[model samples]
Each structure stands twice: as structure tokens, then as C-alpha cells.
Target: MPLSFYGLLEASLLMLNGIAVLNRERFLKKVFSFSSLSHIKFQLIFTRFFSVPLIAINILVILFKLLVG
Candidate 1:
């Protein structure tokens, strides 16, 4: 497998997770909720905030490897 392939996979997973995180209210109402975790909101916020840079970094690294290696 190539770096680009891995990058695509990572980006896809990130997009799925982003969808899940965005629709968390529906998930909680229709599915399940972690009531024990008081910081669930904060965790979701952190995930939404950090995932973009993580995806960007993954793409940049993959491009660098594909171009330079």
C-alpha cells in the first residue's frame, strides 16, 4: 500500500468520525450516552477542534513521503 492510500483512509475515517461527532445529539437520543462521563462535552469539543490539524498533518506527511521518498 502507498502513503496516499493510507492518507485517503485516514481522511475518510476522520470524515466519518466528524459526522458522528457533529450528530452526537441524535446519537445520544437514539442510541446511547455516557452519563458517567461529566466531561463528555469537553471531549467532543476537543475532538472537533483537534481533528482538522491532525488530518492536515497526515496529508502533509503523506505528500512529503510520496514526493521525496
Candidate 2:
């Protein structure tokens, strides 16, 4: 298996898939049904904090893995 392969996989999956799913209002609504308004707001904020950095880091990791071998 690749070094930090699970890390790479997780970051890429969240970067590619989670962003799209969370970005849609309908999906988010369905996900957090019955939750407080504040909680939903927090999730929106957290998503940005979580997913945005993964793209850059994942790219660097992939490049580093390729170059080091």
C-alpha cells in the first residue's frame, strides 16, 4: 500500500465528494433534519474549514509521493 494511502484517500474523497453533497441545500437539510438552526450553521462553517485545505494538501502529498519514488 502507498504511504499514508488512507490519508490520501480520505482527503480526496472529501475534497471531491463531500463538497458537492454538502453544497446542496436540499441534501444538507435532509441530513440535519430536526437539528437546531445553529447546528446547521456550524456545519456549513466547518465544511469550509475542513474541505478547502484538503485540496492543497492532498495535491502536495500526491506530488511528493510521486517525486520521492
Best by lDDT: 2
- The runs of at least 3 residues in candidate 2 whose Cα sits more than 4 Å from the true structure, single-residue gaps closed, are 1-34
Q: What TM-score does model 1 achieve against the real structure?
A: 0.43
Candidate 1 residues 1-69, lDDT tens each?
567977686677667556546665655545554464744875577678877976676687679779988
- List lDDT for all candidates, in order: 0.67, 0.67
- lDDT per residue for candidate 2 within 1-69, as digits (tens), equals 556976677666666655555555666667666567786687768678866766676686678779986
TM-score per candidate, in order? Answer: 0.43, 0.46
Candidate closest to the true structure, highest TM-score: 2
Which residue pairs of candidate 1 clash? none
Q: After superposition, how far is residue 42 of candidate 2 from its true place, in Å?
A: 1.9
What count of clashes does model 2 give?
A: 0
